[model samples]
Target: MDYLLSIIIFFPALASIFIFMMDNNVAKPYGITISLIEFILVMVLWMGFDYSNPNMQFENTFALITTYGINYHIGIDGISLFLLILNAFIIFLGTIYLNQPNDKNHLVVCLLLLESILMGVFSSLNMVLFYIFWEISLIPILYMIGAWGTGEKIYAALKFFLYTFTSSVIMFIGILYFAYLFFITTGKWSFDVLDWYTLTLPFDIQIWLFLAFFVSIAVKIPIFPFHTWLPHAYGDAPTLGSVILSAVLLKMGTYALIRFSLPFFPDASFALVVPIAILALFMVIYGGMLAFAQTDMKQVIAYSSISHMGVAVIGTFALNLEGLGGSIFTMFGHGIISGALFMLVGMIYHRKKTRQISEFGGLAQIMPKYATMFGIVMMANVGLPLTIGFIGEFFSLLGFFKSHPILTLLAGTSIILSAIYMLILYKKVFLGSIQNIKNLTLKDLCPREMTVMISFVVVIIFFGIYPKPILIPIQNSTQQLLQIMNDRAIKENTKIHLQNSLNKQKTALDTLHIQKLLKEVQYA
Candidate 1:
């Protein structure tokens, strides 16, 4: 079991390198087979996972560079396990949906490499190790987008690289700063996150560190203001790139927010709750409204991403069991549903060579299979009941309602707005009359595409209706985290109250000193 985790993490890289060396003819088939093997390994890991344990499992450690106390440390708990599963499943599904039938060896290798890096990022326990995988993960994705994507792919790729790279550099400094502080106090240097967790830094230090960390995670989550790169990236990316980006990569930000930021800077995090929540609210309403106005199918999903992620951020900041749990659940649901949406758009664009909403109408009559799948995915995107989307959203709103009822009310409007625009999209694309001659001959979903779409819908309904499978493990993970935050909040507040009391006593003494000084002057 110790090496079981390492096998899961490293096997994809091995397979990728193998595929890279293979001929293009062989690479495509071999890559898909390798990915399936990897997926099976993940499934085995899932079955073996002891859900009762909230702590990291399948833990493995090897000294990579022990001089600085850095090790190749990796493990997973409930919080990351599902993400790992999502990463493998999406890549496998994306592999099956490759655009070109020409078997591009390099592209196959890049996708395989991406799976490796994503796995490493999820399983990494050491901060430096995590950071290394973190930075490496972007490179293959950059290549994936630039090489295969349409319409200004290079620009989108560079934007993604720059946004992530710049943010990561700041985060690196913060990591160094914390490690240095720990060294100064304890005569040791380490980049283990769990090690850094114990250092009680001053409030000022936590604030700066929090911002540095926030910049990196925020850029990935692209939480408002910083989210400008996402639409262009997601819109221009190839179907595989778009699916991977939405399904797995973006969640890295939300995951890191839980693993690193919130726990490390509890005081600063608490101070930030209101402002972040307000920003999240703006994302919900603004993103939804922008999505509503979009004519391009890809752009609609891109903006809708912003809207959905806004709710994720709100749920995250709520800082309670339901909120945190829902945020994680939402992350999982968003990955599955958004991936399907993008893939569906890609299918249409593949056949019709156009994504304009006006270009599509009455597709249902011509392509009932595609329309059926499309309708299911669209409704799921809009958070329909008995689907995965509803559970995450329902819980997130429920959680937010506890803290800020008014903001929750505003966030709830996204529900209405999303349904309106998404349904309008479905009607325009699939229903009505075939207004254009070209639309009459459109093909239904192919076997491979049909399989992928059905898989997504099934997972959506499965998790949506019975979320306990996901929720139970997450509950164990988040409960421990919430308790930690609660304890930290209590301790910090108590310390502040005591400090204020002492300041009041000092003020009384100062007043007495001034009065005594005046009496001495009068006596003289």
Candidate 2:
């Protein structure tokens, strides 16, 4: 168990090298075995995790650059624990789905490497190490999309790389400047996020730094105007690529907003809430409309991702326990729901050799099992009650409503929009009489595909019914984060903002009956 975090972080990378050298015949089996082991390791970490403790656990630090004070520091709190598990779980399923004979060993290698890099991203406490992992993650994904993707794959890959990388460079500049400020304030050098949190920055400086970080995070979240690359990337990338991109990669931006932006620049976050909320509300309605307009199945899911992520963004900036917790939970919910949807679409494409919604009809007649699975996932996507998706959206809207009621009303439109588009998609794809000759003979879910779908359904429903286990830890962490933001606010206005938000958050929690649940969990 010693260095458990390090081992979990590096094992996939080491395994990728070995799998790369594997013969094409055994490569998939070896890759699956390796990924499964990694998943198990992550589950072990989760099992042993101290959910009641909000601070970082299993920390390991080493001075990688002594003079610059950039150490190889890593740890995880409740906020990061499930994200790590999610990364591992999704990669395991992705590897299993990539069982096509033509799936080269290198593809598996790229996936494993991406897993390792993302693991580091969620766990690293040092900003320098986090950035290193963050930047390196682009390589495998770029190669995956460019080499194995569909139409305009190379163009999509390049656009994705350019947009994300360019914005990241701006963030790096912010990181360096922020570090310099840290040195100036303390007469020492450090890129540790914990250390940086101790510094009380001027409101003016915080605004500049917040923008520097926000650009990169927004582009990754693909918020509004910056989201142009996503449809192409999702539409053209291979199914596995789409799954990973939607499920894990997109969350990176929202997660960073929670991990860095709110805490690092509380004043800026409080000051900019209205504008950010406006953009988020716009994305919610806009992405939903675009999703409704899509002909291609992949593109529909891609646009829906943008819409759902907007909710997460709103929750994050709500700057309270209900909003932050809901945002984090929504990230997980969206990951599972969206990934399942892409997988179902990929299965259809595999049989029909097309993703155009018009090409197929009455799929339920030919592929009842597949249709059923898709229906469940689609319902979750729509945020139907008692599904995993509902919990996050309900809390996110509730939390944000406390901060901005009118904006939350606009944001709530996403729920109706999502239901309309998703049900339309289901009806078009599965309800009508079979029209195409090819569709009449299409096969249903096979055993392998059934296994994956079943797993997704089980998790979705299980968590939906009883989310307290996850919610408790998330609330614990968000409480600590809010405390930090509250404690670090230098401006009187910022202090008042934090206090008002906290009061509203407390009221929301009480109304939702979550405070009772939290106290019970704590007593137990």
Candidate 3:
């Protein structure tokens, strides 16, 4: 337990507390050292991880309520493996790459504590435990934004918190109801997801639970209509907060879809797949249109995240190996691509004191290295051939093509739309006459900045050309997830039983079962 999942989850908080006790000058380096240590430990997890095996690994359990068969459980599977690594690695680079005007101790602590809670979200195997981590993760980001953010910071913080928290309350209700369903069928209570995956619930209940969970994921991913909070949150947050939000936090929604929604309610998932795809198609078009219309660099990038995530959602709900595999890959690739973009934007803002596209021009000549790095990362963002972004989008659209050809065509338009906006952004921001006289003296990327951007480029190119390492580990798990949906579609026996159970009258106590469970958890 000392060196396994618990350490990966708790190490950041431990270091954060210690960092708080240190001198202000010492806190940054101390946080960086601990972050690197955490990164190495994740590498160890990866090295020890049997990539050939798709089952959950390094499982650790602690009893929370043995009488109810609920416990604190955490584990990792192939799908979550590299993401865990990405979370640790990006935060490491973030700590070092940080040149924020302020060197406040509380900011560093907030970032590290965020790392710990995010790790908890990715690792938890129990429903209530996962929900707890999910809820807690929002607090650090709120602190970072409200205390350190710029324009509309408090409003953005509240919007982000309220949008996600309100949606999550729905998900929590779904989870509790799911556990209650288990009790009626099995004569006991349990919140273990692995155990719930084995239960068969009514199709009627699946639809309710599916919508409940979908509302939550949609808000987090901010699919189309639910995306109102993103631009504000991303535009108003600090660089590090924006970076983590783009890189890791958004993926939690898609990851949860794969982890909870697909497995737990296969019939309802299959039933709703098309409508979801249509919504995703709208997301791609709408997000791209908004991005194309933006004059501010950060707003464009923020909206672009919405567009790329639309592709990820399409891939995931394809419910095939290619679709699911591509979705996982997209999460990692988008994190890198978007994270690098935000970092570069931060660098520019640091020097220019502006994020306005109109203010920039002729940076390629002034800052040759930074401009070149921007070209490379932007190309990857546009899904250039032999880049990490291409592999994910290609496979996702390909997977979607099998099941929904027409919708896939509409979704694929994002490819051209993304290029148009991104290239236009490049021309506006990096090419043309030097508009501002003061910009002439602007310095190029320094040594530390190059380390971060160059590292991002190397990974993007190497993996873009050869995605075998990423694809192979996820195939077995993705295939298993696909099978669960297929099985639910054909299993008449369970379906019939579930149908029969739904016909029974709801009791007064049945309505209170949820309330009773809520109280138990409140004092548990």
Candidate 4:
């Protein structure tokens, strides 16, 4: 299975060259065919996955840089498996939806390359390999925005690149520092993630190292203060670009928090939990308020993403199984619901040539099917019952409540606020008297677009009704993480206790020796 994971990760990349060479007339069909094959291969991997095991599956390693202690290692756990499937699913559907045979051949080629790098990021077991994939993945997106985006694409792409790139550089240094520490302790040089787990750093070192990693993941998650670039990126990117960014790319950050941050710095994580939760709380409330202030439908969803990610991150820092599970689950839900919402927004933009909510009204009267689908998706975005959105939000809030009941209650405002903004956006666009004459004759979704959206709707509804499949695997993964945290904590406490005992014994021995010397002097 070592090569199996590599094949899945790299095949699309190899296929991308062929895709790039193809004439425009055959590009769409060719892209779709390759993507279908890639997606099916992911399904095959899923069917053969050993659900009972929490350890990395299909593990493989290759010597890439022995001098630098870097190796090309790859594997998947339950947490990553579903995400890989999600990536494949979204890209495949996105290809079908992007059926512009005569246009944007280069864009299709870039997305294929992006898909391959993303798979590598999710599946890589070695820390350095993961970092390499992580950095490489950014190139296509930067190019996508600069080459294919609109309304200040260059500015948006440059900003996106600088923000994420700076963080990745910092994280690389942190990784190297930690790997060096591992070598010093055990006389072995390895950049394997599993090995790093056993190389515990002192408290002060952990704090600084954790910050280095945190900055990178937080920027990726784009939590609150760090989220300035996302709105522009989302708003400027093409429909397909926005969908891929929302559905798959953003998850990279949140997923990193779970995969690397929590395990590597458990004590620091435990200590910073309260402050981080507060930040999340603020992001949830503030981002929703800003969403309501937006006239551009795309910007509304953009701000809403910041708010949703806040909930996801807070759940992650809860450091408990339920919270951690909910964080991962919410990320999954956000990928589907938000991705669909972006697509819907793009559909509106393509038809009306504007994203202003005021440009639409009484769409239900003209386009019933489109209106109905938008309403359902809007409801999910608001975290209404019986939707995938509800599962992640409910569990995340519940997890926060365990430790910070008051913060949990305050953070709960996102649910209400999101509903308010989303519903208002929905009402303005789809209901009320027909304000714009242009909307009266707007075309409804084509079969291809409708099929793509309906597929997402089906996934959201399926998970909402029965999340057991997702929950079981996430639970196993989180349980193992918790065990490692507990073990680390216990060892630290034991070390402190033993040090104190040794100091006490040394003091007592000195006192007894002094008394014996005094008695001998008295006898002399």
Cα lDDT, all candidates: 0.83, 0.90, 0.86, 0.82
lDDT of each residue in 175-286, candidate 1, tens digit only: 8888889899789888887777676667778789999999999899878889889988898888888888988999999999988888777777877878888888888999
Candidate 1 lowest-lDDT run of ten:
509-518
Q: Over the stretch 416-435, how does candidate 4's per-residue lDDT look in tens digits?
A: 99999998988888888899
Tell me the tens digit of each residue's lDDT in model 3 across 330-365.
999999999999999999988988899999888888
Q: Pick the candidate with the highest lDDT.
A: 2
In candidate 3, position 488 carries an lDDT of: 59
Work out how many backbone clashes candidate 2 has.
0
Taking the tens digit of each residue's C-alpha lDDT, what string does model 2 give over 240-283? 99999999999899989999999999999999999998899878
Model 4 lDDT on a 0 to 1 scale: 0.82
TM-score of every model versus the real structure: 0.92, 0.97, 0.93, 0.92
Q: Measured by TM-score, how close is model 4 to the native structure?
A: 0.92
What TM-score should be assigned to candidate 1? 0.92
User: How much does each candidate deviate from the true structure in C-alpha RMSD?
Assistant: 12.2, 2.8, 10.4, 12.8
Clashing pairs in 3: none
